[model samples]
Target: MAPEPVRETDPTIGRLVTDASRDISSLVRKEIELAKSELKVSAKAGGLGIGLFAAAGFIAVLAIIMLSVAIAYFIHWAGLGLHWSFLIVFGFYLLVAGLLVFLGVRSVKKVKAPEKAIEQGRQIPQALKGKS
Candidate 1:
Protein backbone atom coordinates (compact mmCIF):
# COMPACT_ATOMS: atom_id res chain seq x y z
CA MET A 1 0.00 0.00 0.00
CA ALA A 2 1.26 3.51 -0.85
CA PRO A 3 0.85 6.46 1.53
CA GLU A 4 -1.50 9.16 0.26
CA PRO A 5 -0.38 12.82 0.15
CA VAL A 6 -1.95 15.01 2.87
CA ARG A 7 -4.03 17.99 1.62
CA GLU A 8 -4.90 20.36 4.48
CA THR A 9 -5.90 23.97 3.81
CA ASP A 10 -6.63 26.98 6.11
CA PRO A 11 -10.29 28.08 6.26
CA THR A 12 -11.14 31.24 4.28
CA ILE A 13 -12.12 34.41 6.14
CA GLY A 14 -15.69 34.22 4.81
CA ARG A 15 -16.09 30.64 6.05
CA LEU A 16 -14.76 31.57 9.49
CA VAL A 17 -17.12 34.54 9.72
CA THR A 18 -20.13 32.44 8.70
CA ASP A 19 -19.32 29.80 11.27
CA ALA A 20 -18.93 32.37 14.01
CA SER A 21 -22.22 34.02 13.11
CA ARG A 22 -24.04 30.70 13.21
CA ASP A 23 -22.53 29.86 16.60
CA ILE A 24 -23.51 33.24 18.07
CA SER A 25 -27.09 32.90 16.79
CA SER A 26 -27.37 29.46 18.31
CA LEU A 27 -26.01 30.70 21.62
CA VAL A 28 -28.53 33.54 21.73
CA ARG A 29 -31.45 31.18 21.07
CA LYS A 30 -30.34 28.85 23.84
CA GLU A 31 -30.01 31.75 26.25
CA ILE A 32 -33.51 32.89 25.45
CA GLU A 33 -34.85 29.40 26.18
CA LEU A 34 -33.05 29.31 29.54
CA ALA A 35 -34.53 32.68 30.50
CA LYS A 36 -38.02 31.53 29.59
CA SER A 37 -37.75 28.42 31.74
CA GLU A 38 -36.46 30.39 34.69
CA LEU A 39 -39.22 32.97 34.37
CA LYS A 40 -41.85 30.22 34.29
CA VAL A 41 -40.63 28.94 37.65
CA SER A 42 -40.68 32.41 39.17
CA ALA A 43 -44.14 33.10 37.82
CA LYS A 44 -45.49 29.88 39.32
CA ALA A 45 -44.10 30.82 42.72
CA GLY A 46 -45.60 34.28 42.50
CA GLY A 47 -49.00 32.87 41.58
CA LEU A 48 -48.93 30.55 44.57
CA GLY A 49 -47.99 33.43 46.83
CA ILE A 50 -50.87 35.55 45.55
CA GLY A 51 -53.34 32.72 46.11
CA LEU A 52 -52.16 32.23 49.68
CA PHE A 53 -52.49 35.96 50.36
CA ALA A 54 -56.02 35.94 49.06
CA ALA A 55 -56.93 33.03 51.31
CA ALA A 56 -55.43 34.86 54.29
CA GLY A 57 -57.49 37.92 53.47
CA PHE A 58 -60.68 35.86 53.33
CA ILE A 59 -59.90 34.30 56.70
CA ALA A 60 -59.29 37.75 58.16
CA VAL A 61 -62.70 38.84 56.95
CA LEU A 62 -64.24 35.85 58.70
CA ALA A 63 -62.37 36.78 61.85
CA ILE A 64 -63.89 40.26 61.69
CA ILE A 65 -67.37 38.76 61.43
CA MET A 66 -66.66 36.57 64.44
CA LEU A 67 -65.47 39.60 66.38
CA SER A 68 -68.70 41.40 65.57
CA VAL A 69 -70.69 38.44 66.92
CA ALA A 70 -68.55 38.40 70.05
CA ILE A 71 -69.26 42.08 70.63
CA ALA A 72 -72.98 41.50 70.25
CA TYR A 73 -72.83 38.67 72.77
CA PHE A 74 -70.93 40.86 75.23
CA ILE A 75 -73.65 43.51 74.99
CA HIS A 76 -76.12 40.95 76.36
CA TRP A 77 -73.82 39.49 79.02
CA ALA A 78 -76.23 39.84 81.96
CA GLY A 79 -74.70 37.27 84.38
CA LEU A 80 -74.11 35.05 81.29
CA GLY A 81 -70.56 34.37 79.99
CA LEU A 82 -71.53 33.16 76.51
CA HIS A 83 -69.41 35.95 74.99
CA TRP A 84 -66.28 34.02 76.07
CA SER A 85 -67.04 31.24 73.59
CA PHE A 86 -67.37 33.64 70.66
CA LEU A 87 -64.19 35.45 71.73
CA ILE A 88 -62.28 32.15 71.70
CA VAL A 89 -63.51 31.31 68.22
CA PHE A 90 -62.50 34.75 66.94
CA GLY A 91 -59.01 34.32 68.37
CA PHE A 92 -58.60 30.96 66.61
CA TYR A 93 -59.62 32.47 63.28
CA LEU A 94 -57.12 35.26 63.71
CA LEU A 95 -54.34 32.77 64.46
CA VAL A 96 -55.10 30.81 61.30
CA ALA A 97 -55.16 33.98 59.18
CA GLY A 98 -51.79 35.01 60.56
CA LEU A 99 -50.31 31.63 59.68
CA LEU A 100 -51.53 31.89 56.09
CA VAL A 101 -50.05 35.36 55.73
CA PHE A 102 -46.72 34.11 57.00
CA LEU A 103 -46.69 31.25 54.51
CA GLY A 104 -47.62 33.61 51.68
CA VAL A 105 -44.75 35.91 52.49
CA ARG A 106 -42.35 33.02 52.51
CA SER A 107 -43.57 31.83 49.10
CA VAL A 108 -43.25 35.33 47.65
CA LYS A 109 -39.72 35.55 48.92
CA LYS A 110 -38.92 32.32 47.11
CA VAL A 111 -39.76 34.03 43.81
CA LYS A 112 -36.36 35.32 42.79
CA ALA A 113 -34.46 36.61 39.77
CA PRO A 114 -33.02 33.98 37.42
CA GLU A 115 -29.52 34.21 38.73
CA LYS A 116 -28.07 31.42 36.58
CA ALA A 117 -29.51 32.80 33.38
CA ILE A 118 -28.42 36.33 34.23
CA GLU A 119 -24.90 35.15 34.97
CA GLN A 120 -24.75 33.21 31.73
CA GLY A 121 -26.01 36.22 29.78
CA ARG A 122 -23.35 38.37 31.31
CA GLN A 123 -20.71 35.94 30.17
CA ILE A 124 -21.83 36.29 26.55
CA PRO A 125 -19.88 39.47 25.97
CA GLN A 126 -16.77 37.93 27.43
CA ALA A 127 -17.28 34.86 25.31
CA LEU A 128 -17.58 36.97 22.18
CA LYS A 129 -14.34 38.70 23.08
CA GLY A 130 -12.64 35.27 23.30
CA LYS A 131 -12.36 35.47 27.10
CA SER A 132 -13.38 32.70 29.45
Candidate 2:
Protein backbone atom coordinates (compact mmCIF):
# COMPACT_ATOMS: atom_id res chain seq x y z
CA MET A 1 0.00 0.00 0.00
CA ALA A 2 1.27 3.46 -0.90
CA PRO A 3 1.35 6.13 1.82
CA GLU A 4 -0.60 9.29 1.01
CA PRO A 5 1.49 12.34 0.16
CA VAL A 6 1.82 14.66 3.18
CA ARG A 7 0.36 18.09 2.38
CA GLU A 8 2.26 21.19 3.46
CA THR A 9 -0.80 22.51 5.38
CA ASP A 10 -1.77 19.62 7.74
CA PRO A 11 0.46 17.31 9.84
CA THR A 12 0.67 13.72 8.49
CA ILE A 13 2.12 11.85 11.51
CA GLY A 14 -0.76 13.05 13.73
CA ARG A 15 -3.26 11.80 11.15
CA LEU A 16 -1.40 8.50 10.85
CA VAL A 17 -1.33 8.02 14.61
CA THR A 18 -5.02 8.78 14.90
CA ASP A 19 -5.87 6.36 12.10
CA ALA A 20 -3.74 3.63 13.68
CA SER A 21 -5.42 4.15 17.05
CA ARG A 22 -8.89 3.94 15.52
CA ASP A 23 -7.96 0.88 13.49
CA ILE A 24 -6.47 -0.89 16.48
CA SER A 25 -9.56 -0.09 18.56
CA SER A 26 -11.81 -1.45 15.83
CA LEU A 27 -9.68 -4.57 15.50
CA VAL A 28 -9.78 -5.30 19.23
CA ARG A 29 -13.54 -4.76 19.33
CA LYS A 30 -14.09 -7.06 16.41
CA GLU A 31 -11.83 -9.68 17.94
CA ILE A 32 -13.77 -9.55 21.23
CA GLU A 33 -17.07 -9.87 19.36
CA LEU A 34 -15.76 -12.85 17.43
CA ALA A 35 -14.71 -14.53 20.64
CA LYS A 36 -18.14 -13.88 22.16
CA SER A 37 -19.97 -15.27 19.14
CA GLU A 38 -17.85 -18.41 19.04
CA LEU A 39 -18.43 -19.02 22.74
CA LYS A 40 -22.19 -18.56 22.32
CA VAL A 41 -22.41 -21.05 19.46
CA SER A 42 -20.34 -23.58 21.36
CA ALA A 43 -22.46 -23.15 24.49
CA LYS A 44 -25.68 -23.65 22.54
CA ALA A 45 -24.43 -26.81 20.89
CA GLY A 46 -23.13 -28.25 24.13
CA GLY A 47 -26.35 -27.35 25.93
CA LEU A 48 -28.43 -29.00 23.24
CA GLY A 49 -26.32 -32.12 23.37
CA ILE A 50 -26.59 -32.30 27.15
CA GLY A 51 -30.32 -31.65 27.02
CA LEU A 52 -30.88 -34.39 24.46
CA PHE A 53 -28.74 -36.76 26.45
CA ALA A 54 -30.75 -36.01 29.59
CA ALA A 55 -33.98 -36.63 27.70
CA ALA A 56 -32.65 -39.92 26.46
CA GLY A 57 -31.68 -40.89 29.98
CA PHE A 58 -35.13 -39.97 31.24
CA ILE A 59 -36.76 -42.09 28.57
CA ALA A 60 -34.40 -44.93 29.38
CA VAL A 61 -35.30 -44.79 33.05
CA LEU A 62 -39.00 -44.78 32.21
CA ALA A 63 -38.61 -47.70 29.86
CA ILE A 64 -36.61 -49.62 32.43
CA ILE A 65 -39.30 -49.02 35.04
CA MET A 66 -42.02 -50.24 32.73
CA LEU A 67 -40.03 -53.30 31.69
CA SER A 68 -39.16 -54.11 35.29
CA VAL A 69 -42.81 -54.04 36.31
CA ALA A 70 -43.71 -56.31 33.41
CA ILE A 71 -40.94 -58.76 34.23
CA ALA A 72 -41.77 -58.82 37.94
CA TYR A 73 -45.38 -59.64 37.14
CA PHE A 74 -44.27 -62.35 34.75
CA ILE A 75 -42.02 -63.90 37.41
CA HIS A 76 -44.84 -63.72 39.95
CA TRP A 77 -47.03 -65.67 37.51
CA ALA A 78 -44.30 -68.36 37.55
CA GLY A 79 -44.74 -68.75 41.35
CA LEU A 80 -41.88 -66.47 42.52
CA GLY A 81 -42.75 -64.48 45.66
CA LEU A 82 -44.12 -60.97 44.76
CA HIS A 83 -41.66 -59.02 46.98
CA TRP A 84 -38.64 -60.99 45.74
CA SER A 85 -39.60 -60.36 42.12
CA PHE A 86 -39.87 -56.61 42.75
CA LEU A 87 -36.54 -56.62 44.58
CA ILE A 88 -34.88 -58.18 41.55
CA VAL A 89 -36.36 -55.48 39.33
CA PHE A 90 -35.15 -52.78 41.71
CA GLY A 91 -31.64 -54.19 41.66
CA PHE A 92 -31.64 -54.11 37.84
CA TYR A 93 -32.72 -50.45 37.83
CA LEU A 94 -29.97 -49.53 40.29
CA LEU A 95 -27.41 -51.07 37.99
CA VAL A 96 -28.75 -49.13 35.01
CA ALA A 97 -28.77 -45.85 36.96
CA GLY A 98 -25.17 -46.41 38.01
CA LEU A 99 -24.14 -47.01 34.45
CA LEU A 100 -25.96 -43.89 33.29
CA VAL A 101 -24.24 -41.75 35.90
CA PHE A 102 -20.82 -43.06 34.92
CA LEU A 103 -21.46 -42.44 31.22
CA GLY A 104 -22.88 -38.97 31.82
CA VAL A 105 -19.83 -37.89 33.81
CA ARG A 106 -17.52 -39.13 31.10
CA SER A 107 -19.47 -37.31 28.38
CA VAL A 108 -19.46 -34.04 30.27
CA LYS A 109 -15.77 -34.31 30.98
CA LYS A 110 -15.07 -34.77 27.29
CA VAL A 111 -16.94 -31.58 26.30
CA LYS A 112 -14.47 -28.69 26.20
CA ALA A 113 -14.90 -24.94 25.63
CA PRO A 114 -14.01 -23.29 22.34
CA GLU A 115 -10.25 -22.71 22.44
CA LYS A 116 -9.10 -20.93 19.29
CA ALA A 117 -10.99 -17.69 19.80
CA ILE A 118 -10.01 -17.67 23.45
CA GLU A 119 -6.38 -18.02 22.51
CA GLN A 120 -6.65 -15.19 19.97
CA GLY A 121 -8.24 -12.96 22.56
CA ARG A 122 -5.55 -13.80 25.05
CA GLN A 123 -2.90 -12.88 22.50
CA ILE A 124 -4.48 -9.53 21.62
CA PRO A 125 -3.55 -7.90 24.91
CA GLN A 126 -0.16 -9.48 24.87
CA ALA A 127 0.44 -8.29 21.30
CA LEU A 128 -0.67 -4.78 22.15
CA LYS A 129 1.72 -4.82 25.07
CA GLY A 130 4.54 -5.66 22.64
CA LYS A 131 5.03 -9.13 24.15
CA SER A 132 5.30 -12.09 21.80
Candidate 3:
Protein backbone atom coordinates (compact mmCIF):
# COMPACT_ATOMS: atom_id res chain seq x y z
CA MET A 1 0.00 0.00 0.00
CA ALA A 2 1.30 3.49 -0.91
CA PRO A 3 1.62 5.92 2.04
CA GLU A 4 -0.62 9.01 1.79
CA PRO A 5 1.28 12.34 1.29
CA VAL A 6 1.20 14.63 4.34
CA ARG A 7 -0.45 18.02 3.57
CA GLU A 8 0.55 20.10 6.61
CA THR A 9 -1.33 23.44 6.79
CA ASP A 10 -0.01 25.51 9.71
CA PRO A 11 -2.89 26.04 12.13
CA THR A 12 -3.98 29.72 12.51
CA ILE A 13 -4.16 31.35 15.92
CA GLY A 14 -7.99 31.40 15.74
CA ARG A 15 -8.08 27.68 14.85
CA LEU A 16 -5.68 26.90 17.66
CA VAL A 17 -7.73 28.94 20.08
CA THR A 18 -10.94 27.20 18.99
CA ASP A 19 -9.32 23.75 19.33
CA ALA A 20 -7.98 24.62 22.79
CA SER A 21 -11.38 25.92 23.88
CA ARG A 22 -13.12 22.80 22.58
CA ASP A 23 -10.61 20.53 24.29
CA ILE A 24 -10.99 22.44 27.58
CA SER A 25 -14.77 22.17 27.37
CA SER A 26 -14.49 18.42 26.72
CA LEU A 27 -12.06 18.06 29.63
CA VAL A 28 -14.44 19.93 31.95
CA ARG A 29 -17.38 17.68 30.90
CA LYS A 30 -15.27 14.57 31.55
CA GLU A 31 -14.27 15.85 34.99
CA ILE A 32 -17.91 16.54 35.88
CA GLU A 33 -18.84 12.99 34.77
CA LEU A 34 -16.04 11.55 36.92
CA ALA A 35 -17.20 13.56 39.95
CA LYS A 36 -20.80 12.40 39.48
CA SER A 37 -19.73 8.73 39.22
CA GLU A 38 -17.57 9.05 42.36
CA LEU A 39 -20.40 10.73 44.26
CA LYS A 40 -22.86 7.98 43.25
CA VAL A 41 -20.50 5.32 44.62
CA SER A 42 -19.93 7.25 47.87
CA ALA A 43 -23.66 7.87 48.31
CA LYS A 44 -24.43 4.15 47.81
CA ALA A 45 -21.88 3.21 50.47
CA GLY A 46 -23.25 5.83 52.84
CA GLY A 47 -26.83 4.58 52.34
CA LEU A 48 -25.72 0.99 53.01
CA GLY A 49 -23.93 2.08 56.19
CA ILE A 50 -27.03 3.90 57.39
CA GLY A 51 -29.19 0.83 56.66
CA LEU A 52 -26.84 -1.46 58.60
CA PHE A 53 -26.77 0.91 61.55
CA ALA A 54 -30.59 1.03 61.62
CA ALA A 55 -30.75 -2.77 61.48
CA ALA A 56 -28.34 -3.01 64.41
CA GLY A 57 -30.43 -0.57 66.43
CA PHE A 58 -33.64 -2.47 65.58
CA ILE A 59 -32.09 -5.77 66.71
CA ALA A 60 -30.90 -4.18 69.93
CA VAL A 61 -34.40 -2.90 70.69
CA LEU A 62 -35.90 -6.36 70.06
CA ALA A 63 -33.31 -7.90 72.38
CA ILE A 64 -34.18 -5.43 75.10
CA ILE A 65 -37.91 -6.27 74.79
CA MET A 66 -37.21 -10.00 75.08
CA LEU A 67 -34.98 -9.46 78.11
CA SER A 68 -37.69 -7.41 79.81
CA VAL A 69 -40.25 -10.15 79.31
CA ALA A 70 -37.87 -12.84 80.57
CA ILE A 71 -37.06 -10.80 83.68
CA ALA A 72 -40.76 -10.29 84.38
CA TYR A 73 -41.38 -14.07 84.12
CA PHE A 74 -38.50 -14.77 86.47
CA ILE A 75 -39.91 -12.35 89.00
CA HIS A 76 -43.26 -14.13 88.80
CA TRP A 77 -41.55 -17.47 89.50
CA ALA A 78 -39.93 -15.86 92.55
CA GLY A 79 -43.41 -15.66 94.16
CA LEU A 80 -44.46 -12.21 92.95
CA GLY A 81 -47.88 -12.18 91.25
CA LEU A 82 -47.71 -12.07 87.44
CA HIS A 83 -49.22 -8.56 87.29
CA TRP A 84 -46.87 -7.19 89.92
CA SER A 85 -43.90 -8.92 88.28
CA PHE A 86 -44.50 -7.18 84.98
CA LEU A 87 -45.17 -3.92 86.77
CA ILE A 88 -41.86 -4.15 88.58
CA VAL A 89 -40.06 -4.87 85.29
CA PHE A 90 -41.79 -1.88 83.64
CA GLY A 91 -40.89 0.37 86.59
CA PHE A 92 -37.27 -0.77 86.43
CA TYR A 93 -37.11 0.04 82.72
CA LEU A 94 -38.56 3.51 83.41
CA LEU A 95 -36.01 4.15 86.15
CA VAL A 96 -33.16 3.03 83.88
CA ALA A 97 -34.46 5.18 81.06
CA GLY A 98 -34.68 8.23 83.31
CA LEU A 99 -31.12 7.65 84.56
CA LEU A 100 -29.89 7.32 80.97
CA VAL A 101 -31.62 10.60 80.01
CA PHE A 102 -30.06 12.39 82.96
CA LEU A 103 -26.59 11.10 82.12
CA GLY A 104 -27.02 11.93 78.44
CA VAL A 105 -28.04 15.48 79.30
CA ARG A 106 -25.07 15.85 81.66
CA SER A 107 -22.66 14.52 79.03
CA VAL A 108 -24.08 16.88 76.40
CA LYS A 109 -23.81 19.83 78.79
CA LYS A 110 -20.17 18.94 79.50
CA VAL A 111 -19.34 19.16 75.78
CA LYS A 112 -17.65 22.46 74.93
CA ALA A 113 -17.31 24.12 71.52
CA PRO A 114 -13.96 23.75 69.65
CA GLU A 115 -12.71 27.21 70.59
CA LYS A 116 -9.02 26.29 70.28
CA ALA A 117 -9.46 24.88 66.75
CA ILE A 118 -11.50 27.94 65.72
CA GLU A 119 -8.78 30.28 67.10
CA GLN A 120 -6.11 28.33 65.19
CA GLY A 121 -8.14 28.55 61.98
CA ARG A 122 -8.59 32.30 62.47
CA GLN A 123 -4.83 32.68 62.87
CA ILE A 124 -4.20 30.91 59.51
CA PRO A 125 -5.17 33.95 57.33
CA GLN A 126 -3.18 36.26 59.58
CA ALA A 127 -0.17 33.95 59.38
CA LEU A 128 -0.45 33.68 55.56
CA LYS A 129 -0.59 37.48 55.25
CA GLY A 130 2.47 37.85 57.57
CA LYS A 131 0.33 39.71 60.11
CA SER A 132 0.66 37.11 62.89
Candidate that scores best on lDDT: 3
Q: Which stretches of candidate 1 lie over 4 Å from their true place?
A: 1-7, 78-132
Where does candidate 2 stray beyond 4 Å? 1-6, 9-11, 81-84, 87-132
Note the clash tally of each candidate. 0, 0, 0
**Tens digit per residue, CA lDDT, model 1, 1-132:** 998765567677898999999999999999999999999999999999999999999999999887778675765574446766566667877899999999999999999999999999999999999999
lDDT of 1 at 114: 97
lDDT against the true structure, each candidate: 0.87, 0.93, 0.96
| TM per prediction | 0.52, 0.55, 0.68
Q: In model 3, state the lDDT of residue 24.
A: 100
Clash pairs detected, candidate 3: none
Rank by TM-score, highest first. Answer: 3, 2, 1
Instruction: Name the candidate that leads on TM-score.
Output: 3
Assess the local accuracy of residue 91 in candidate 1 as a C-alpha lDDT between 0 and 100: 82
| Stretch of 10 with least lDDT, candidate 2 | 4-13
Q: In model 3, what lDDT does residue 128 have?
A: 98
Per-residue lDDT, model 2, residue 70, is 94
